[model samples]
Target: MNSAANAHLINSESYVQKPFTLPNGIVIKNRLLKSAMSEALGTIDNVPTMKLATLYRRWAKGGVGLCVTGNVMIDARAIGEPGNVVLENDKHMSKLKLWAKAGTCNNTQLWMQINHPGKQVPKGLNKNSVAPSAIGFGPALTKFFEIPRELTENEILDIITRFATTASLAKEAGFTGVQIHGAHGYLVSQFLSPNHNQRTDQWGGSLENRMRFVREVYRSIREKVGEDFPIGIKLNSADFQKGGFTEEESIEVIKTLTDDGMALIEISGGTYESPVMALGSNIKESTYTREAYFLKFADTIRQETTASGLKIPLAVTGGFRTTTGMADALAHDNLDMVGIARPLAVDPDYPHKVLSGQAKTNPIRAISTGIKFVDDAALMEVAWYTRQLHRMGVGKNPKPNEGAISSLVKTLLTSGYKTFRTRRLRA
Candidate 1:
């Protein structure tokens, strides 16, 4: 497509500060969605803390139309990290209500990203990690994560119920919406990967079967929330691994949900193993020029789905750093919203800056010491960004200029020790 044709395709200015309406009739005030980032601020009991309320209030005031909370594990026994919040029952309603109010002030929609960590659960975190098939994280990841056992038929049925229960609890606690965490190699994501899910039963093997878990989870949540409440899903464009969940399969899964009246679909890719979703990967020079890392695949989706006469509300997250990139994607109708994470971590008011013409460019600071190994550590990014969130949780401004090495040391000193000591995992 020529620049003129691209300009003609979806004029880049039409959606600057535009309000977005989901298919289920929920109208977001703007096109920016605060993508889910693990806050790890819960109490020892896996309950929401006042710190979470404080942190979200900051983001609510930051001008995002919708804010998706860090991953809320559906079952307490299975968690990806030490401070992960779990919503298995209504016991934490009061704290949840407080978090909800802070997040929903000014008409902002706070959608809880509910998930099950499955085999991704760390060693010693839980007695036994489980998945669609008994698979171990390959050699590179084995040291950090435990080998998982295959879930039994009964266990699978119970997990589906757990998802619905959490969704119902979220609505009761006053959240505006719920997003199923079906991406980034969580439980649902694992099921989608042919390499991970090898069962011949209805919940595995074929693509249709592999998708059944997510489909059923969506249906269960819908039943609990009724038809009016919005439900969104964050899905991978591809797993970016050989013999893993393919881009073609992802489109098919998306179409199935779109046909079933899914309200929103956010595209993200990679997992803890590949970690491309965190912007760590070999990239083409052309890719760096684009705002979102997944837009190329998203463009492929637009082509395929439009040919089928379907238009789903799409949001693409990752590598978005400028207004021009955001505007072009929205104007061209490639995506309905921009899912901003790291940029929002440091500057909560990034959407405001973009909409109000104040932010020219927010530089993504490289976290490195010039030592190849230290620079290449995956936990370095998580450790750095997570500390920034803790600062906001405690009413402190994010130390965006903090050195990467110091951030990692502080995080290990603070969260790492506590995480290792806590047996908060579900039994």
Candidate 2:
């Protein structure tokens, strides 16, 4: 198609597109966002590294509108995984500034995703991981995570403040926005999911109660940063595991967030038992078979928003590969943005390719990272790259753990590191 024709396909008024605007006036250069993918490259102290800078610089240059940093923990003790950058103090501001500058070099919006591990934290990292309630996720698959301790009401409030403080730090460090990581069975997702959150207090039991912590966190962040700073979240459309967070409940939560002034909401799903979002090698193959695995759920939410007259922008990730599919989704589905994680990892310039009409199909393959099953060679290769980025000062270094390679790979997958060669595998 010619430029003018393609422009019409993308938008009617012009053949060229403009930036996507969030509620708070934060404008992304385009509809593409590099979804948060954990690099596990932070320093031993969990500060950002030059390797992280390198990684983001590459992605920023690739042409995505926004690049979200992976898992910057709000509390040191509640880390989601080893090597996750902890954002508890102002001391790390310089490092964060470096990361932001590197990531936004191409005028891309850079958002740091703040989170807590809750029960998902490995026992090796903290034997007493805190949660909204004292509940084990399921059978102990690893020696790492023990039964987590329940957070006191005071602890909950402290965590809320921590989120706000972290957002303030991110803003100071030069981030364009902040994304609360509330998906994939982390602390915030744990509280949102009924199966994990079994508390009797105001923080649990009912859907409204389960959503209270996230609401408070959002309110606190808005209060600390004011309305101009963009705030977004990644939420599960459904947990997929039995008795966990469901589509029905997720819709309700999205509705609540829309009312609470969320600028963007990315739809995702699955948790430990299922691990859908991370592995991408599920037997169900939702994204492979069904384009945009979370579309049905997102459509329901969008319908709800339209019916109720809500205007928050929605970004859908997972199983979005083809440019035509993405364009069709934005034009027909009413979704404001498209999120590409693994494909962007393999080919960072994918968005530019799509927009320039060079590529029409998604480049992601079903190639397994082989780390999912704890392959030694695979683990070592991933560790080497992770450490290499750290050595290069792009991010922090994850502790080498052969058994935890699956989790490590999951983090990498979330960050967009899909292409690899066995020859590149090294410890």
- For candidate 2, lDDT tens digit of each residue in 229-270? 989999998889888898888888888898889989998888
What is the overall TM-score of model 2 with all chains considered together? 0.84
Clashing pairs in 1: 10-331, 76-426, 77-426
Give, for candidate 1, the lowest lDDT window spanning 10 residues.
Answer: 5-14
What is the clash tally of candidate 2?
Answer: 26
* lDDT of candidates 1 onward, in order: 0.86, 0.74
Candidate 1 C-alpha lDDT tens digits along 314-361:
999988877777887876678998898988889987878877866676
TM-score, per-candidate, Cα-based: 0.95, 0.84
Tell me the lDDT of model 2 at 87. 88
